[model samples]
Target: MKINNKDEYIIIVGCGRLGSHLASLLSKERKSVVVIDNNEKSFNRLSKNFSGFTIEADAIEEETLLKAKIDKADVIVTTTNDDNTNVMVAQIAKSIYKVPKVIARLFDPSRQEIYEELDIDTICPTILSAIEFKNIIIEAGGED
Candidate 1:
């Protein structure tokens, strides 16, 4: 689903690199955003100009999801470093809270099929990086 509307409510789980970047971008575009993370310091990744709300709590916890008001979220993104945690958060947002759109970041490409089976959208950096590196090698005349 597209997030062209600036008035949409976006919830991002994990305030790490990806999560913070998304929060900043959405916030800049005037979307209502809430970022959740277990470590308070992780929020530091967010830009100083970010105007979104932040909650220091484990996103895998149901209470934390409730506190973030997931029920009202138009989109939920899970970008924690751990694949399992990201999957759990994405599942909770999509399955339990019934968030309209749920996206997750997974480092392990092997587990992507599992999430896809559950109907959750995923972005796998590992796979993307491999593709980019393969392209670079091919450009350099390296054999496949």
Candidate 2:
């Protein structure tokens, strides 16, 4: 889902490297964002310019999602390093909260089909990196 609208409300699960970066970027674009993470220190990864709210909590709990206002969120993004956590939160956002757009970062390409079946969009860094590396090798005329 293309989140081109800056006015959209966004809820992000996890405040790790990827989550913090996304929250910061969306904040810069003037989107209303709420980032949730179990570790409060993780929020530190967010840029100094970030204007969004940060919540320290486990996203797996329904109460946490509720406090993040997931019900009215236009987009919910799961970027935790753990594949299970990401998919679980993404599924909740899509199936329970009925968020219009749900995006997740998946490390294991093998589990991608599960997300696809749930109709939740996933960004698999491992697969993407492999594809990029393959393209670069092909461009260099392949290895002998």
Give the Cα lDDT of each candidate.
0.89, 0.90
| lDDT tens readout by residue for model 2, 1-144 | 678665489998888888899899999989999999999999889999999999999999999999998899999999988999999998888988889888999988888987798899999988889999999989887565
What local lDDT does model 2 show for residue 8?
84
Query: What is the alpha-carbon lDDT for the whole of candidate 2?
Result: 0.90
The reply for model 2, stretches above 4 Å from the true place, is 142-144
Q: Write the per-residue lDDT of candidate 1 for residues 35-114, one digit (tens) a residue.
A: 99999999899999999999999887889899999899889988888989999989988888898889999988888898
10 residues in a row with least lDDT, candidate 1: 1-10
Residue pairs that clash (backbone atoms under 3 angstroms), model 1: none
In terms of lDDT, model 1 sits at: 0.89
